[model samples]
Target: MNNSLQDTLALVGRILLAWLFVPAGFGKIAGFSGAVGYATSVGLPLPEVGVAVGLLIELVGGLMLLVGFMTRPAAVLLAFFTLVASFFFHAYWSLPADQAMMQQLMFNKNIAISGGLLAFAAFGAGRWSLDAKRQRV
Candidate 1:
């Protein structure tokens, strides 16, 4: 594809992907205790600390991805986070008989999101990104 088309696609992908995390982070922030409880239920070591760190990564990293600032690094971090979440929280590999259909759906979605983040890491922020401007200087 031409440069302009590539740039537009990248920007749209970044926005859509980043928006996915923003509400999640905001939900954690809005329901701090519920987030803590959920984290604990998931057997996350140091539930409070994990929730804090996860929220920051989701919120700040999502914003950075959206703006294309530090896009490559942000994408890498988010991708890693997605992988971990998929395995641990989403239980992508575990086919528990008791798991609800929604749980299975979440697992698949997390895996897909991880793939998208990996794509961003590989293809980069494209022409319209702050990273591009920085690269030119």
Candidate 2:
């Protein structure tokens, strides 16, 4: 594809990826106690701290991805974060039969998202991004 097309695709990908994370981060902030409760229920050590870190990563890392600022690092961070979260939040193997299907779907979805993020980390943000602009300066 042409450079313009590639850049536009990258921009769109970043926007789509960020869409899932940014809103989730805000939701975590809005429902902090509930999030902590959920984390605790999941047996996460230091549930509050985990929630805080998740909030930061989802919000800040998501914004960084949307803007394509430090895209590689942000993508890498988000990718790993998503993978870890999938194991905790979407543990299909631990669920009963009916619930297992849904959890499996969610787990697969997160895996796909992580794959996209890893692609961004490996390739970069493209010409429409802040990372690209920074390179030019």
Candidate 3:
């Protein structure tokens, strides 16, 4: 494929992926106490700090991905963050049987999302990105 087409595809992909994270981060901010509570309930130490870091990763990292600025690093950060989240929030094996299926599904989804993020980190944001612009300078 032409570089132009590839770049467009990368831009669109970044936008689509960021769509999931940006709003999620905003929602968490809106419900900060609730998020902290949820994090605590899931057994993470320092729930407040966890929620704060979560907001930064989801909101700031997501915006960086959306704009294709420092895309690979942002993607790498998000990938690690999501993987940790899956373990902490979706510990299906420890849950009761009835809730296990849904938790398992969520766990799998986080893994899939992290996989995509890793792929993006490897492939980069293409020619349309700020990273590309910097490379040309």
Candidate 4:
């Protein structure tokens, strides 16, 4: 209803979404070998490169989102990344019964996250963002 509230929501939303990826990126890099191994297990070709690209996208794109800089592009990139990850790595349908439930949950969660990213891309970062500041100048 109000600009202030709208801006606050945008900033908080950005922070909330960014947290999901920031620690994950840090952890992936911190345990680089483990991430690569997991990627390999998922049958991604060039697992090392995949892990590196994922780490870069999560870390850099996530930070850009947090600061509301390049917000639309960053959100779109992450959204695409999430969709691919959900289908490829978290494909619950291909798993055994016991593992299927967990994978399915993860897959669903990723899909929901992608929806949020898409919304952000449509709305643009609100007035609290660097994008907004640049617009004023």
Candidate 5:
């Protein structure tokens, strides 16, 4: 593909992926008490600390990915987080019938997000990214 097309694709990918996390981080922030309760219910260690860290990764790391700043590291960290979330909260489990489908959907979504993050890690931030500019310098 030509440079223009590649650049456009990268921009689109970054925007779409970054947009996904913004709401998640905002949700964690907006619903801090609920998040803490949920985390504790899920048996996540240090629920408050975990929620804070998760919020930071989803908000800051996600924004960095959007702008292609520290793209590689951000993507990797987000990918790891996504994978862990999938296993912890979204994995197929013996839950009540009403909630089982929702859990399945969340699991699938996290898996897909992880795939996207891995792709970004492999491809770098593209021509329009800070990583690319740094490379040029």
Candidate 6:
């Protein structure tokens, strides 16, 4: 593809990726107690802290991705975060058969999301990014 098309795709990709995380971060903030409770239920130690960390990653890291600022590091960080969350929250193997199906689906989805994030990390945010702008300076 041409550079212009490639740049547009990178911008769209960042927006799409940010859509999943930014809203989730806001939702966690809006339902702070519930998020903390969910973390506790999932047996994560320091549940409150975990929730706080998750929201920060989802929000801050997500914004960085949306703006294509430090895109590589942000994508890698988000990918790692997604993988960790999948293991903890979507542990399908530990669930009953009925619950396992949905959890398995979620786990696989997260895995796919992580793969996309990794692609961004490997390639970059393209010419539409702050990273690219900074490079020109």
lDDT of 5 by residue, 30-72 (tens): 9999999999888888999999999999999899999998898
lDDT of 2 by residue, 38-113 (tens): 9999888899999999999999999999999999999999999999999998999998998999999999999999
Model 1: residue 27 alpha-carbon error in angstroms = 1.7
Q: Rank the candidates by TM-score, best first.
A: 2, 6, 4, 3, 5, 1
- Assess each prediction's global lDDT (C-alpha) against the native: 0.87, 0.97, 0.93, 0.93, 0.90, 0.96
Residue 83 of candidate 1: its Cα lDDT?
75
Q: Compose the digit string of candidate 6's lDDT tens values, residues 1-137.
A: 99999999999999999999999999999999999999999998899999999999999999999999999999999999999999989999999998999999999999999999999999999999899999999
Evaluate residue 94 in candidate 1 and report its C-alpha lDDT on the 0 to 100 scale.
58
Q: Where does model 5 exceed 4 Å of error?
A: none
Q: What residue runs in model 1 are displaced by over 4 Å at the alpha carbon?
A: 92-100
| Residue 59 miss distance in model 6 (angstroms) | 0.2
Model 4 steric clash pairs: none
How does model 4 fare in lDDT?
Answer: 0.93
In model 4, the number of clashes is 0
What's the CA error at residue 53 for candidate 2, in Å?
0.2
TM-scores of all models? 0.91, 0.98, 0.94, 0.97, 0.91, 0.98
Question: Which pairs of residues collide in model 2?
Answer: none
Best by lDDT: 2
Best by TM-score: 2
Residue-level lDDT tens digits of model 4 in 1-137: 89999999999999999999888889888999999998889898899998899999999989989999999999999999999988879989999999999999999999999999999999999999998898999
